[model samples]
Target: MEFFNSGLRKNITSVHPAYFIIGGFIGIHNVKYYYIFLSLIYILSVLGNTVVMTVIIVDHSLRTPKYIAVFNLAFVDLFGSSALVPKVLDTFLFDHRYISYNNCLSFLFFCFISLAMQSLNLVALSYDRLMAIIYPLHYHVKVTHRFMLFFISFLWLFVITVTLFAVGFLTRLSFCKSVVINSYFCDHGPLYRLACNDVTPNYAIFVFATGLILWTPLVFILASYCRMCYALLKISTSKERLKAFKTCTAHLSLVAIYYLPIIFVYCFGASIHPNTRILSLSLTHVIPPMLNPIIYVLQTQEIKESVKKMLKFRGRTKIATKN
Candidate 1:
């Protein structure tokens, strides 16, 4: 009720801009080169994630609860890259920085939802690993096929609802002070802080998003690994412990590639130059999606084997065709 009344008040009073100028790359020279590199990254991300998903789908062997999480992770990376990259190329490379208010909101929603789901899916993968290692006997009961679907469904709903709320609050803000957004995409912080009216709700959601999506997922993963390590210590055989830990290498590598730059950027963002901050943050978002599938394919024996089987099958079919 208060939200509606506040919306009505803001609608009558707020000076909504027709278009907002994206000034994230305003002063940087030769920045088109970076965007050009990002274009190549996007292509690789698309190809890698597509191959991962295709392998998971085509091979019935990967139909377990664990691969479901892996499939979802690959899908999220692909979806997130698709949502962000082309627009980013157009916005910076072609100098099309004037984004309409509604389009900006839509862009914010998709990008934020993808960002949220990316971390949540990692949380899902971490849970799968934790169950397999820590609760080996109950791994089936704890993370069944049905349970994984339910868990992913619930997380999707929760993430989408929260992202919508965050975007909704921006509608009530009057942005008369400025229409220049200082981030690569329509970042919540720079956009909402530009508003002239009450921004408490918007600011609150921004902080909440940072914690909920960024820090919280990393914490959950780290805690899960700690528990696994503790459990591994109880195993008397060094070989067994190493073998058990080996299963976690892919997930750990994913966490590192995804979270390290992000942590670095947010932790040291202020002291750094704005351009440097943008570059750091941009890479944080872009690099992980490209690397996730590569990490899994190279580090995980299962995926590698599946890929080999598919290639062998394809080669046999080709030979048969020749025959």
Candidate 2:
């Protein structure tokens, strides 16, 4: 009777002290191929974001508020990918699947922090564009260098405060016996699902934090676009209106790149299997950073001219050296 009761108890209690992240794409016989592919992505993402930062910092002409926001976005993308990708790479390449209790929470914390920063940076970018398009005369006064610096500082502090609150609630949750996490990384949903106690409070707080960090900036971006639209309608010439709309193409593309994957993951995550979800999430982290510079910053007329000038200067110097 005692042995039977013990078995029953084990069956009833599924919570565990620590969890194992099973990782993604277990069906692949050769994980090395995945490693090589992801490593290329990681390398490209870092290099691309770094180039944007370098261009913005070194070039005096590119020091406008718009490029400054682009620089900040690059930084967020670099940091966020750094936080998640190496660990993912290790899991697949090295087969190191075990994560400690505290590490899991830390990972989850930083993940959300990066997310908060990205959303905040997007808001800054939208505001820059909105002011430039809708209120060109007031743009200088409204988006002064000092004002942008202060806004960025406030965003970092606010996001930290909100993330701290969420992590505090996360710390209080208790895990029982079930230790295997389905996702590749330590995601909030997967982590909270392992808790033995009621997770309603955690879920509620997460919803609140998401509203503040994600939805708020999204609303701001949408409003800015609407204002831009109204301003565009006031233009009498179709050619001028089309020209004005053309300026928005890069920003609009970036917004779509960043948000669409996120919406798909959150809304349809349950319907998709775990492995596919993991791959999709990984792509979200890797692909956007890689494309941001190519799509938005590098393609700009100013940056293109700068690159050409630098190349010409280098070629001239090389010819002089040969002489």
The top-ranked prediction according to TM-score is 1
Residue-wise lDDT of candidate 1 within 7-122, one digit each (tens)?
A: 33433335677777777876789887898899999999999999999999998988999999899989999999999999999998888987888999999999999889988898
Model 1 C-alpha lDDT versus the unseen true structure? 0.88
Clashes of each: 0, 6
Global lDDT of each candidate: 0.88, 0.78
Candidate 2 lDDT over 1-323, as tens digits, reads 23322333443334445444544566646757867888898888898888778877877988887777788888988998898778888876888876776787788788788878987888888888888888878999989888888888888899989888888787777766455665777777777876789999999988899888888888899999999999999999999998888777888888888888988998998898766787788777677777888786554777767667767888999999999
- TM-score per prediction, in order, is 0.94, 0.90
Q: Which 10-residue window of candidate 1 scores lowest in summed lDDT? A: 1-10
Instruction: Please state the error at residue 111 of candidate 2 in Å.
Output: 2.1
- Candidate 2 residue spans exceeding 4 A from truth: 1-23, 28-32
